[model samples]
Target: MKDVKTRAETLRRTIGHRVVDGKDAAVVTVSQSYPTDADDLWDACTNPERIPRWFLPVSGELRVGGRYQLEGNAGGEILTCAPPKSFSATWEFGGGKSWIEVAVIPEPGGYARFELAHIAHPEGDHWETYGPGAVGIGWDQALLGLGLHIDTGAAVDPSEFEKWSLSPEGLGYVRESGNGWYDADVAAGTDPDAARARADRTIAFYSGT
Candidate 1:
């Protein structure tokens, strides 16, 4: 298993807000480097069967302008696709429309970097209540699973994840991830007390504590 403390310190997380086309949106960005070639990392992310191994089971046409859905998760339209490099898509879920983009960058020594940005326009009180950790934690967990999958070439079982999340180590990782995003929010100008409170709620939601 990957070291939790190492990941918490190594993986990069950023949060910011923006107004796009007259609509305000919250942006969450996460990035991590993996020990794999760019093509392999891209395939691990975009391949239909491989997705569920790390993230969630996904089904869709997958071509540009095609629609796709993650089982009991987000569904969206594929906006753009560039081989072994990047992809952009619309993220629609919980009665809201958002956007997501993933970029794969090649590095020296056969390593690859994955960067993900999730943007959503929070409707009334949502941002104050949950903050970025609402989705950021989920993405962090997905990234962790992806790292494990790449290192071991074994799919993560959902049931195993459930039990692990309740363990002390898992709970600590979840809490730290939430707090990391909260710090990012504060750096982006959110009130410190408010951001910390929201982080507490996010941690509870994910850790089920």
Candidate 2:
């Protein structure tokens, strides 16, 4: 693998989700500036042959309103596609429909700003039982993988990468992301303390704490 430039300095932000109708619906936004041209980054994301190198093996028609499937992963309808600038799709996973949008904006110095947003189901009894440390953490890892693949041209297996989510560093990431979710839950009018406690327990369960 090539030496990928570190984006830790520019990871910028992580915002958690607000609960809606007793369900834990959340959004995670991650951004990074890559030292590559916009077209290259765009192709990496939308090009079928190149997608599996960074994400999952995706097979589908490359057009708006086309249905596509990610090998062993989520499959959904393409809601929008604006070439090298934006792509939005319905991310159907675990019998639920969510939204994923990616935007690529060019910077002055041969760089591009990439932002990913995942809008998920809200917090509820089902969310509480399933735990708080689920989707957000997974998305965090996916963003990391995107960064690595863009910089190094190497792909990280999602399943293998998930194992790292249970490691010490991974656990820390989970804790932080979970706390963000809890905060968002509170902001959305949920019980803050209860949400935090539930999030902590979920982290512990995943981390063996």
lDDT of each: 0.90, 0.70
Model 2, 1-209: lDDT tens digits are 22222333235445466664566666667677788899998988888888887678889876899999998889999989888899999999778888888999999899998888777775356566534345555555566677778777877776666686666666666666566556655665667767677777766665776
lDDT computed for candidate 2 = 0.70
How do all models score by TM-score?
0.95, 0.73
Clashes of 2: 13
Q: What lDDT score is found at residue 13 in candidate 1?
A: 88
What number of clashing residue pairs does each candidate have, in the order they appear?
A: 0, 13
Task: Give model 2's TM-score versus the native structure.
Answer: 0.73
Q: Worst 10-residue stretch by lDDT in candidate 1?
A: 1-10
Q: Number of the top candidate by TM-score?
A: 1
With candidate 2 superimposed using the best TM-score fit, by how many Å does residue 109's alpha carbon deviate from the native? 3.3
